[model samples]
Structures are given as C-alpha cells and as structure tokens.
Target: MPDRDVRPVRVRLLEAAARLLADEGPRALTTRRLASEVGASTMVVYHHFGGMPELVRAVIVEGFARLAEHMAAVPRTADPVADLGRLALAYRANARANPHLYAVMFGGVPLDGQAPPAEEPVAGRAASGAGTFGVETFAAETFGVLVEAAARAMDAGRLRRDDPEHVSAQLWSAVHGFVMLELAGQFTGGAETVLTSMLVNLGVGLGDAPDAAARSLRAALDTPAP
Candidate 1:
C-alpha cells in the first residue's frame, strides 16, 4: 500500500487554496474546488475555517506570516536605516515571488464572489469580532516590524526624531509605491537603481549623514538578498 499524506487538514486546505488563487486567481477558489484540489470534502474546509471568508482570511494571514519571516531574516547591522531598506527589498521580493497572492493580499482581491473586509482592525484587539480574524492581526504585526525598526533607528540617533509610526508609514508608502509600479511593469530602466536612490534619499531625510548613508545603502544593495 502507498504511504499516506499526514499533513494537517488545515495545512492542506491552505496550500490548495494558495495554489488555486495563484494559478487561477481568487475567483477559482471555492470550497468545492479547493476540496477537489486537495482530494478532500468541502466539509473539511468548513471544519477547519468555518467558511470561505474565514479561509480566505487565513490565506492572507499566511501570506503576511511568510512576509514577516522574510523581513526578519535580514541581518541587523549597525545601520538601522540600511536594515529598513533591506526589509523593503524583502517586501518587494516577497511580492515578486507571489504576484497572484500579492494582489489578493494587498490589492483587495475578492474571494468567493465576496470582497474582503473594508477596514483593518488593530492587531491583537479581538479575534472574535467581525473582520478581526487573523487577517488584521497578522497584517498589523507585519507592519509593526517596520515601525519597530524605525524606532530603533531613532533611538540610535540615525533617523529623525519623529514619530516612529509616521516615519515607518512614509517609508512604507514610498517602497510600496515603487514596488507596485515595478510589478505593473512601469519601470523601463533599472528599477533597483531607482529603489536604492529613493531609499538613500529617505535615509538622508531621516537624519543620517548624506554621504555615509548613501555609501552604506549602495554597499547594502551590492549584497544580494536571499
């Protein structure tokens, strides 16, 4: 007899759902379709996730978890600004690797003919509340990584003494905009050069000495991210 696949049902379901979404887009992810893909019954999804919305929520949460792992893997050096830039590159890499899922994760792609929740609740507030499943919690946690990095830079006197949250939000906006444009194929020339320039400029604006920060950013870009 053949050996059995012993993975948890929830894991199997999430994997199938991710593949379905990646291969065919969100519209292809239905309970029946996921069940068929995983060689299970629709009841399995219900048993694990309660319903399609919750399952979709799980998928988004899983994407953020992977993203956080990728960012966290960046080695922290004396330069916090450079560290933040490394995290931004990790963010872009994650999106590039998971283009289809990236859309669903941030572009507000619908699932099962229903749109995702409009508002993102604060992380760790309440999971039982509507739209408060792992979705908002994981998303917030992922963003928190950037915020905390900014705080560290501020404490080290490498960045401007502004609100860390605000600083992170600005950096995030710049990185996300560039990434979105890159993913859209708007970059006719060297996107990495542009990204590095923007990051260097951001570092200068923050508080770092312009010459040293730019040199560090250029050097950091030389080291390829995993």
Candidate 2:
C-alpha cells in the first residue's frame, strides 16, 4: 500500500496522550513515551502536536471542553438563583465524575498564561453537538448570569441597590473558590455538603432574605414527583 493514512494515526496518538495524561500526571507526559503508549511512531506524535508544550496545551484545552460539557449540562431554571445553585452543584458533579480531568485542568494547569491554539473544538463538543466554550468566555457568561440575578433581586427590593459588577464578582469568587478548593481536595465533606454551603453563601449575597433563597431551594428539592 502506498499509504493507508496518517491522519487517523495522529488522532489516535492524541487520544492516547489524553488518556495517559488523565491517568498520569504531567510528569508522565513525554512525546516519545506517548508514542510508545499509543503504539505510533514518535514522528506521528511530533507531527500531530508539534512538540510537548503544544501537546500539553491541547490536552488542557480538551480538559476544559470536558469541564464545559459538565457545566453546560446544568439545567437552566426560570429562577436565576436556583439556576446558579444548580450550576454550582453541576460543577461539583463534573469534578466528581471526572476527577482525572478535574485534577489536570484545575490542579496545576495555567489557562490564562497564553491563548490556546485554534484547532478542532474537541471530543465533548463533537459528541454533544454543541460548540466549545472557552474557560474565560464561560466565566464571562456566568458573570452575566450573576448580574441578571442580582438585578432581579434588587428590583424585587430584596437585595441592596449596589453595583451589580461588584456583587457579581463577589458571588463568583465565593462559588468558584469553594468549587476550586473542593476539587483540590481541600474540603472534607461530599459534594452535596460543599454545594449546600456554597449555595448558602451565594444566597446571603444574592437573595433578599436567607429564607427567600432557602424557599426556592426547598421547592427545588421538593419538585413534584412526576
């Protein structure tokens, strides 16, 4: 055969690298080793990814896409505050579901250092039939959601009339810090407990009365059995 193909080979190499990186740490990722692990020629990995740094970055991007898949799956509610809590819990669910990806994506990876290479969206988007959401872009979108929620609360005369940007930042920091720390194995309890605590803190800042947020939560919990 003149040549069966190399594109498939390159894709396999990337898949192998992703799996290994998920199972092993960054220290275990090497182009040569990855080639061996994938049963492909070293040239294939090098040709496909350019170099180790590029390959590592690709993995990081893929990991973020996976995280986005989990986040995107969180149900959007008519109640923005409830939507926020659901998103928070969904974040924890993603971490628990894919600890390996979570570890690499959030553990030691630096997303803000440099922009990721523009390439295919990755497995999650293709599988889910949805577009990829960059981490920063997603953060911005989530921030917008928080701002809308804050605005709603204020209009209802629940929350104080303050800067939505400031309140949004504060609330984002609270939820992100909690989830990030919990994923880093800093918390002792299960995700549900962590979620409860985070939602309570979020409510304090976003809801009129703590009870107002709590009632919404209680209703979610007692969603009609159908």
Best by lDDT: 1
lDDT of 1: 0.76
Q: Model 1: number of clashes? A: 0
Per-residue lDDT over 1-226 for candidate 1, one digit per residue giving the tens place of the 0 to 100 score: 9888798777667767776776687788888999998789888778877777767767676677667777878888887777887888888888887665576677535455645444444544432223334666667777898998899889988887999989999999998899889988899999978998899899998888899778778766765664
TM match of model 1 to true structure: 0.78
Q: Model 2, range 73-137, lDDT digits (tens) per residue?
A: 65555665665555555555666665555655554443333334554453443211124444445
Off by over 4 Å in 2: 1-25, 107-159, 162-165, 219-226
> Local distance difference test, per candidate?
0.76, 0.59
In candidate 2, residue 205 scores what lDDT? 59
Give the C-alpha lDDT of model 2: 0.59
Model 2, position 104, has a per-residue lDDT of: 55
Could you say which candidate leads in TM-score?
Answer: 1
Q: What is the C-alpha RMSD of each candidate to the true structure, in Å?
A: 4.4, 7.3
